[model samples]
Target chain A: MKKQRFDYGYILTLLISLVVALLIGAGILALTGHNPLVAYRALLGGAFSNARHIGDMLEYAMVLCLCGLACDIGSRVGIFNVGGEGQLLLGAIFAAQIGVWLKALSPWLAIPAAALGAMIVGGFYAWIPGVLKVKLKVNEVITTIMLNTVAVFLCQFLAKGPWKNTNKNIVAGTGNLPGSFWLKKLVPGSNLSTAIIAAAVITFLVWYILQKTSKGYEMRLTGDNPRFAKYAGMKTERIVLITMVISGMMCGLVGMFRVYGAEHIYKSTVSNEYYFEGLMVAMIAQYAPLPTIVISLIFAILKIGAMGMETAAGVPKQLYLIIQTIVIFCMAAETGIRAAIARNRERRAAKQDVKARKEGGNEHA
Target chain B: MHNNIWSTIFDPGTFSQMLRSATPVALAALGGLMTEHAGIMNIGMDGMILMGAFVAAVGSYFCASAAMGILAAMLFGILIGLFFALFTVKLKSDEFIIGCALNTFALGVTAFLSREIFGLSGTSGYAVPSLPNVTIPLIDRIPFVGKVLSGHSIFVYVTWLLVFLMWLFVYRTPMGLWIRASGESPETLRTVGKNPERMKWIASILCGVFCGLAGAHLSLGYLNGSFVEGMSASRGYIAFACVIFAAANPPRAYIAALMFGFFDALGLRLQSYVSSDLTGTIPYLITIIMMVYVVVSRQKRRERLAKQQLQRLEP
Candidate 1:
């Protein structure tokens, strides 16, 4: 019953937050001497203007979908994994290692090897912090973030030192994977790859795990009330560790797909925007599997469109980042609303008690 | 240019580098300590630092005064603090989420402003009038210690003083007692006719002030008065780790901050011989090790206590 009421509140909060955020975006554009309408139109047009643009946007959305699912796995189990960027990079490096080193293998063998490699490495790397959290009671958030820093540097090291491609003559990015390792592009001349199918499959799998399985129930219980779950004989520690590993594995898929489906080479300089975008997607979707795709698509449109706005309309791409932050702030503010409602109830109850005392006094008189 | 990475460990330059690098983190760590004791964690210190750096750079650049830059940074800190308190304290928002949002938002707005105003991601290397490095009288005559400590921006000295003050503030003062009570038991604070929420807001504001100063030091003092897109480089996160390392103790946190700074300096020094990228991971890796040690030791202590209780019961 409370969840139903909160559903309405969440929608109201989202709508209000979006409106305020848009207004702020417009104000910022104006302050920078750009026409907000033209810029927005350019942005929309750029994201969906051509078949190719739409495909690009879809590709980004697909990648974000997997990342969001990764986030959802941890969040639903009451863990905050801010190491999505690190995990993704670790996956990329693993995929790159297989794709580049094992270049002689057939397409069938090479592709699966790359995918499996990414998943295992990403999951295993994240499992360290999971063990720390479960056995030693170390806070996962700090550990994950620290690991992210390490992972980022590790990727950079590989690119610059051991994996340097003399052919590319660049120090920061690995060489492109063999064509056989690449995901077959869906739309010719677009980043849209077989990754979209992977996104769909993963979505279904996440839904199944979260809804149709006893494990899912246990995980949700752990998230909702860990003490209650423990009292009910659930091993909350094992659940947390498994959930983190699974979440990290899902993030690994994002890196693998990006390597095979999107960027052929891992660019260390690429902004970590997608990591946070995934987090935001999962948050806005309330950790549900399906809604994450929709949220991811919306973000992809803004991000891809912002490039167009930058070129044709003289607006910076940072505008999308600003909007993302606003949405996150609004969503986070929901907790504040929850607290306020409780306070109001307490005040009302106190008032009723006073009224009852007064009625009793009058009756005695 | 020694091939040995270990040799640089004893170099006086390395120590000075650590001192310079740790100054900002130590300040930010102390700030975070305030919020931690008040039962809040300002994970958004990175954002506050970025905003402070940008505003300080802008202030110093336009007004041509380092003093103005510091002042501007502090003012903006107060503003950000109020913004944080309003959302986290008054509205009771999820502090971590709000903090992450604030940091991201700060990154965006500052990047946008910098691009719009200066048409660059970082400053254009103009001569930015910064706080002058000072050479202490007798200290300058000493050897390695003098070289390490004598010459630095005034903010470096201020940080040491602030650390001492914070130690006193969190431990000796009545307000310090209240802050601890707020974190430990807000219900107790309420029973005593005080608002724990209000205390958190105050802590948040103080955090902002310290974070702001940290940023000013980075942009105006350390970076020679230049605002860079990511000059903070997760120092805020490092500061967060330092808070955990010291468990909210100001002096110990200061030491923790220096430890990271030392590793960071070591990474830079090792770059001539080893892969710099690999070396750069040292600070983060050490931080993780420190966290693991702290937890492991605590767990061991708990196990020992449990064993002692079991023995007593048996007897």
Candidate 2:
């Protein structure tokens, strides 16, 4: 059970799994009477073809990066906050409410106000499960999952009922926030916003907090060995609460990106898949903040590319989910693959020892 | 309208709605109990149910048979069960993470296939042959009982039977002991020349099958030949919570699911007075509160036991 160095063999296995997944996707397309190559070409072209496509993909990446980081932080503290969807939705709800309420403010003031409002809401939402988990030993997983439905329903109620836009059609959502409250464009003529820049900064800040600070050390210690941390005089309960709240707040920020930066409305139709997809990106990245950014970027391509494939090549956008599933299955089985390799090495070593003894005995005799 | 919600609960119509709503959850809870007793919590029930919902519809839509749809769902359920078993039980991966991944995968794959095959994002009505409601002649003649129980799809009756069967299987049978033993002490089972891992695999697959039927019930029996994105919704998770609430006991789980259903039916009725969206939050809020109560009571019991142990030491 000694720790082995980074195993290239495991990486090879992951590569093979990816190939298998791609081949399966291709085969299915072919069986359904579509050319896989053509479909993939269209996907890539649509996701990366022009400035607009690039901007859209980046926007997705930014949101995913933040959400992934949220889940990653929670995991580090051994809390499975599967209710990221709920937290994200709550953040969006707050952002929309606050953004509209303070529409008269300058862009800088309104932007921070909306984002801060979202973070606080998301944090408080997550705190419920965290407090329950620490004090009463409630399974955070179930509580989080249940809370997700609760969050969405609440968002829907607010969007469609009280806060619903009378100016807009029958769709259940608030009117767009004033244009002044919108996050400034990263490029003046493009769809891209400073949100990506904000996301990047937040990721770095999270990384710094997780790796460098004393608080991060305590949190990681609590996650690695709660009993040990407790014995060492650390307040494990407080750590758990802090980690979960921060994770939820990060999710809230991602919601703000969509509501205040991109969509500019409190719509219940926000992609519920973002929470899961963000978690998937984090899983692929092995939960490192920097690598999370890269994986999220890759995931954004898959997401946007699939939509493009749907429009141009008549392939379903959901094919990417299959690919993502395969990736998860492959990654989740990494330990098994590692164990197999380790066993093979031990068996060969034993065989070599037997042969060496035989030769030594013969020579000595 | 507020009074109407209470009135609806007392009426047979609401009872029918409650039973219908509870059927899928009860079915899935039976499966969830297996995994819970086997030492693995099956969160992937959501995905399995989704897969079952999609595949069952595909089977019926193509073959024009309700039975074929259920069979198709069960088969796909087995496949998902195998994969879940392989990753969690066999590979030693985190069960919760794998379950979450499976749910996402199910949503993605089903959405993809639905769009490709049916060219619809949501609500393909009667894409397959709908299951017929069976009215028992004798039972239909009984006043209130008849109105409440009769004229239900076959799954409704099947769920009632499944609860009893599951209860017997988990509590009475030797296999049931082994499954429970696996969760309690897999090492002890191993010492007795039994493979605890194998037991877990069986329980997981059975859980898959149960959730599959639950999903089938949603598409064919409840909604009757409709396919939509997220049609399974949060029922799988709700069933999971029922398992926790019931402590993996079939009868308790059944009752718990009924309560969940009762709330759902009440919420639907109450929606007439309140915002439909607001009422939708009722079931989730109630579930969370139920969990909180269970956890707090459990902690209190543990504390009492600890106090007793300390008193013994002092004496």
Candidate 3:
């Protein structure tokens, strides 16, 4: 039989699972002697409480979404690019260095120059593992993870030794770039700049490239079946290599945004586990770009709101991390839960058929 | 500067230090090799080690006994192993994703729980007493070997013993045969009425136990009974690499781990004299280069094989 087009029931299942997760989170908060209602209200109010807060959330979302997209590319190609933290870190350094060295250039020229530099360097950083996978068959997971360490060292060396902002009499950061190089802030009373527009545009472009292009189609095919694609004469090796390069470029964009738009300097601390969080966001979105953007915003909101939750309810903001972990556990455990449900339904259906025949016989009698 | 660096790198006292540093990686790698041999790719060794170390510290802290701490750590490892087996073996989930999830889960859970339980952010200090070093009488007198072998923590000796034991277990025993068969011939093992799934579970749990011990060694034996957030770092992945380098053989894995330890010790030594930051980057740099080298060599091998096949066809 031809199947019906839409399944409202499936949508309802997703909505219910989300609600259940939130309720469990609220229960945990209550057990900790904090009023979940007050905390949640504070979270909402704090995140969207003002224009400035909203701007911060947007900027944060932009950075995370780019990183998430970068990770999704690698993940789709069956490469776990755990090196987002490293790639982003290095990208920031490259972009900031360009901004620093070319301080005399016009804002428009220098900003794009810095962004391009970041993409190149970031993409190169990721290409190491891609090439290795194609050549040596060494797992990208280990290589990407190792590259993270290398990236951190490279950042530390630049920050402390050569790129140290010597003029500031402190050795922790790079020299600041010209104010002109900074991306113009679009929104008043918020650092949410025209950069958000750039982010949105890039996301759109990425979506187009992934969905509408033959290269993207080839990439998806290789990701799903490299051997089959090779049989189809698709140059699977080149596709694998290019996919990683693009992934790395996305990471570079994330780094460039953080430096040019927000921090305006490269620091070692930026090499933190933000990349892993980006990976988690990508996983939750199931590697779909649009969903990833939405998930990134949700993550940013939760992180931004958690502070207000802490102050209003006297619950530690670390509890937000706990909630995140629980959500991940729920996501990972989803298939198992659905299987159990399906098994139970099958058994119930079998019993119902028997009972239906008995009732029909009694009615005939 | 050259003299100072060379002296530090080649110092006689450095041998003992190297043993101390290498013990953790070697133990974890040895543990990972067991599962890898059984065709179970264990990426959660780091998480297992982290969980083991955290529990060891917690157990020792309240009980005030290092032995009890180690035992508790083992139990934690078993639990994590079971969780891993449930995902990879039973549910047929992606091992890589599950491993990543476990690492993330461990990081969050440990950090949050550490805060709630100890009112500390990353670690609990003085959770258990540190394991004391034991000097073997005959081995103590054997010059350089004695220096490296004797007067080390109990875990150090246990690690070496476990390597030998693992070698024997894999080569000499029936269970070892089953594990090998499971990885190489799953269908045949099933035909023999042995469940490959069960064997994989056993291997994973065993791996977990070793991982737990590795953690205990880090916290109670090495760090003087403290639980630190992200203490496992990327040692888990490094150990997995060691498994690959060793060709999934326990003895070879131990040797590969020692290589890591040698670099780790070299870094520590260099840190004493050079910039700490530069020295700290050494081990990570080596790991990257090593993996890349492995990849390059593998490519060469594939090309050579293809060339040989073409020559054969030409005849």
Interface RMSDs of the predictions, in order, are 1.5, 1.3, 2.5
Which stretches of candidate 1 lie above 4 Å from their native place?
A1-9, A269-271, A338-342, A354-365, B1-6, B125-127, B304-315
Which one wins by TM-score: 2 or 3?
A: 2
- For model 3, the stretches where C-alpha displacement exceeds 4 angstroms are A1-42, A167-171, A186-191, A269-271, A310-316, A336-365, B120-127, B141-143, B272-274, B293-315
What are the Cα lDDT values of the candidates? 0.84, 0.84, 0.78
Candidate 3 has what TM-score? 0.89
Q: DockQ of every model listed?
A: 0.74, 0.72, 0.40
lDDT of 1 by residue, B1-315 (tens): 443556677788899999998999999998899888988867899899989998998998889999999999999998988889889888977787788788888888888888887775457656566899999999888988899998999988999999999999999998887887888898889789788888887888889989999999999889887888867888888898899889899999999999998999998887777788888899988988888888888789899999999999997
lDDT of 1 by residue, A142-188 (tens): 88888988998899888877776656567677777887778888888
Worst 10 residues of 2 chain A by lDDT: A1-10
Pairs clashing within candidate 1: none
By DockQ, rank the candidates, best first.
1, 2, 3
Q: Comparing to the true complex, what docking class would candidate 1 get?
A: medium
Error of 1 at B307 (Å): 5.0
